[model samples]
Target: DAGVTQSPTHLIKTRGQQVTLRCSPISGHKSVSWYQQVLGQGPQFIFQYYEKEERGRGNFPDRFSARQFPNYSSELNVNALLLGDSALYLCASSPLGGTRTGELFFGEGSRLTVL
Candidate 1:
């Protein structure tokens, strides 16, 4: 089976423009989480969704949002983007109900650049 995958591989946008990133989970998984990885920094959790319901959220601005579909695919939407928002958006997936280790598999991520 294939692992998690994300689209656009790279993205470039001017400040104030919005962007939408997409993700497909690994086979047979249900939980999806979104994270932001700034240069030289670890990814910070943005949101987590399971069964189309919001499971968890991190300390991010309201401009950051996401949702998981019934089929487990997910999309992350960022509004009123800023230069500070430029970062790698990673999508991760794990089995249903999650594991004690939170062993989530990650995608290469969509790299966003704001000018």
Candidate 2:
């Protein structure tokens, strides 16, 4: 029973670049969520998906997108990176369909540094 896992634990990029972060949920979990955590702030919800269909999204701009695979793994892609986009991108998996479930298992996160 592994916990959620995310790749490229940390990375650096310049403005205008694009980045993709990957995640794998804990075994048997069907829901995955993406969150952005800025320094001194709690994680902000970005996207949620269940069974490979998008179920929810936050107030982020069109630059942010995500998709969940048939196996329940997910990817978060940020286009035209801005300095404001630099943050710890967290991936959480739950047994239920949404974040309200309070049953989330989170990965350590992929830290992005935009310059």
Candidate 3:
């Protein structure tokens, strides 16, 4: 019955370091997506996985990657991080094949600060 869960609520890293954020989808959900939200701006979609397969990807650079497990949990990895990459990493989950209502449930998100 949980909505969604993300780990390491916060993180701080230096430029060029790599980081990985994790997420667990809601019960009965089979699709998970990642987003990046910079302060004062709307979230930007990063990646989406359904049934453990990559369904979609946004305009992010090659440094961003993600994968979904069989259990519907997912992880977002960023390589060669830059200060520009500092932002809130959000995880969202929806029903498999999506919902007609076009609603997505999101988690508290992981805040990453790159220096």
Candidate 4:
């Protein structure tokens, strides 16, 4: 089975440019979540979508948004990207959500660089 894959492994953008990152989850999975990893910090949850519905959201600004598709893939879109938004956008997957101790399978991530 194919593991999660993300596009544009590295991206460079100006402070105001918008950016879109893509992710394809492992086969036979349905839940997709997004995390932002800043330098020297643990991944912070951004959003979690299950069965194409928004299950949970994190402490992210409106500029951060994401969606999951019927094929279990996902995309994260950030508008008005700021210099502080420069981080590793990680896409993770789980069979389902609401697990007390579930682990996430992460993609290599789309590294965003802002100038």
Candidate 5:
């Protein structure tokens, strides 16, 4: 009955460092997606996973990657971080086939700060 959960609510790293963010989806949900949100801007889709497979990906650079587990939990990893990469990393979950209104349940998000 819980909503999606993300770990390490905040993070700080220097440029060129790598970081990994974690997410656990809602129970019974089969789809998980990642997004990046910068201050004063909307979230940008990064990656989507369904049934443990990559379903869709946005126009992010190759440094961003994600994977879903058998239990529907997922992780997002970013390599060679840049100051421009600092943002709120969000994880969202939805039922398979998507919602009638096409909405997603999102986690509080992991805040990444790159210097």
Candidate 6:
């Protein structure tokens, strides 16, 4: 059972470009998934797509969207990227959601660079 995994560890994109980041949850723990953006301060809650449906969203604009696959994998897609969008995008997996019981496991994250 591997920990959460993310693809394209690093990427470079220009403003207005579209970017897609992928994530896979641990072998058998996928009740919910979370996407977070990390700048300097810390990880900011971006969105939580549960069981293939959007459960919660952050302050991000409509350009930010995501989806969860049947296999428990997920992808975060951002359209019309902005310089401010450059950050470490993190993915977390949990056996249950809305508990906030410190049961979440996170991945190393994909580093996106907007130029």
Question: What local distance difference test score does each model get?
Answer: 0.91, 0.94, 0.91, 0.89, 0.92, 0.82
Q: Tell me the spans in candidate 3 whose CA falls farther than 4 Å from its real position.
A: 98-101
lDDT of 3 by residue, 52-97 (tens): 9988899999999999998989999999999999999999998855
Candidate 4, residues 1-115, lDDT tens digits: the string is: 7899999899899989999999998887788899999999999999998888888899999998888888878999999989999999999998866734267899999999999
Quantify how close model 6 is to the true structure by its C-alpha RMSD in Å.
1.6
lDDT of predicted model 4: 0.89
Looking at model 2, the pairs that clash are none
lDDT of 5 by residue, 49-109 (tens): 9898988889999999999999999999999999999999999998864423257999999
lDDT score, residue 44, model 1? 95
TM-score of each: 0.95, 0.96, 0.95, 0.95, 0.95, 0.90
lDDT of 6 at 1: 70
- Worst window of 10 by summed lDDT in candidate 4: 94-103
* TM-score of candidate 6 to 2 decimals: 0.90
Per-model clash counts, in order, read: 0, 0, 0, 0, 0, 0
Q: Tens digit of lDDT per residue, candidate 1, span 30-105?
A: 8999999999999999988888888889999999888888899999999999999999999999896543427889
Q: How close to the true structure is residue 75 of candidate 4, measured as C-alpha lDDT?
A: 91
Please identify which of the two predictions, 2 or 3, would achieve the higher lDDT against the true structure. Answer: 2
Q: Residue 2: error of model 4 in Å?
A: 1.4
Which predicted model would earn the best lDDT?
A: 2
Model 2, 9-31: lDDT tens digits are 99999999999999999999999
Off by over 4 Å in 5: 98-101
- Residue 81's C-alpha lDDT in candidate 5? 98
lDDT score, candidate 5, position 94 = 89
The better-scoring model by lDDT among 1 and 6 is 1
* Residue 44, model 4: Cα distance from true site in angstroms: 0.5
